[model samples]
Target: MGYRFHPRSRTIKMDDWIFSPVLQRTYASTEAHYLLLRHLFEGQPIAYCRVSATCNSLNVKARQYHEQMGYKYEGTFRKDNIARWGTPRDSACSSMLDDEWPLNKSVLLTYLLATNFDADGKQIRSLQELRTLQTRCSL
Candidate 1:
């Protein structure tokens, strides 16, 4: 079984493949996450979502993904209750609303354009890059 999201979840475990291999180089994970957010809530308000990375397992690469996707690191969790891969990153998250994206179309578009999967989150070149890698960013 996979993980589920809830309002009470302080830190949510993102998909594994998201940070593995090319997904990290591209926003496949981020887009997937956004699409997940867009579809999961089905027209609901999201204040934030906590994301964590396994220590040594990921570092700047994972952090970069969250940043471009609009997640801010809150802090780290040394130990909560269970043992984890590493210290989990404390991330504060936010996303665009379906309707609000319309009002902020231009701004949102620019944000998307500026976002690059590699070194960025939104990348117009992402398709081409994915094609070269024989990978699909669409989740």
Candidate 2:
């Protein structure tokens, strides 16, 4: 679901993280991705993590999801690859720096807590809502 690279450098590149369509909106993907990040960054020397997604209709939601997870968009790599259909596809790149990880980690942890959900399993507050509130409080 996720990966860590660059043992010598304080950086990791996450590649090929995908979840089945049935798992969407269930928080499985988000939790798994966060766990990978927590494992790599907790008490480790990692400082940056980069992730990229293909620029296509299918991946538009993925890019937005990455942003929701606190990744900052760097730019797009034009014609980064040729799809299996022989169509040129761009890649959107994003990264999360060490300085920004702590807050993100906190937000994720808070969001994942049982108290954040209701009896019906609906979220008491959305991730963005928590992030916004935490960011404002930290200032």
Say which candidate scores most in TM-score: 2
RMSD of each: 10.1, 2.7
TM-score, per-candidate, Cα-based: 0.41, 0.83
Pairs that collide, model 1: 115-121, 115-122, 116-120, 116-121, 116-122
Candidate 2: lDDT over CA atoms?
0.72
- 1-139, model 1: which lDDT tens digit per residue? 1343555743344433234565554444545665554443343555323433222223455555544444335555443323255644333223333443222323223334544334533356543343333323222
Name the runs in model 1 displaced over 4 angstroms: 1-4, 7-17, 43-58, 80-139
Q: Choose the strongest candidate by lDDT.
A: 2
The TM-score that candidate 2 achieves is 0.83
Q: Write the per-residue lDDT of candidate 2 for residues 89-121, one digit (tens) a residue.
A: 877777887678889899999989999889987
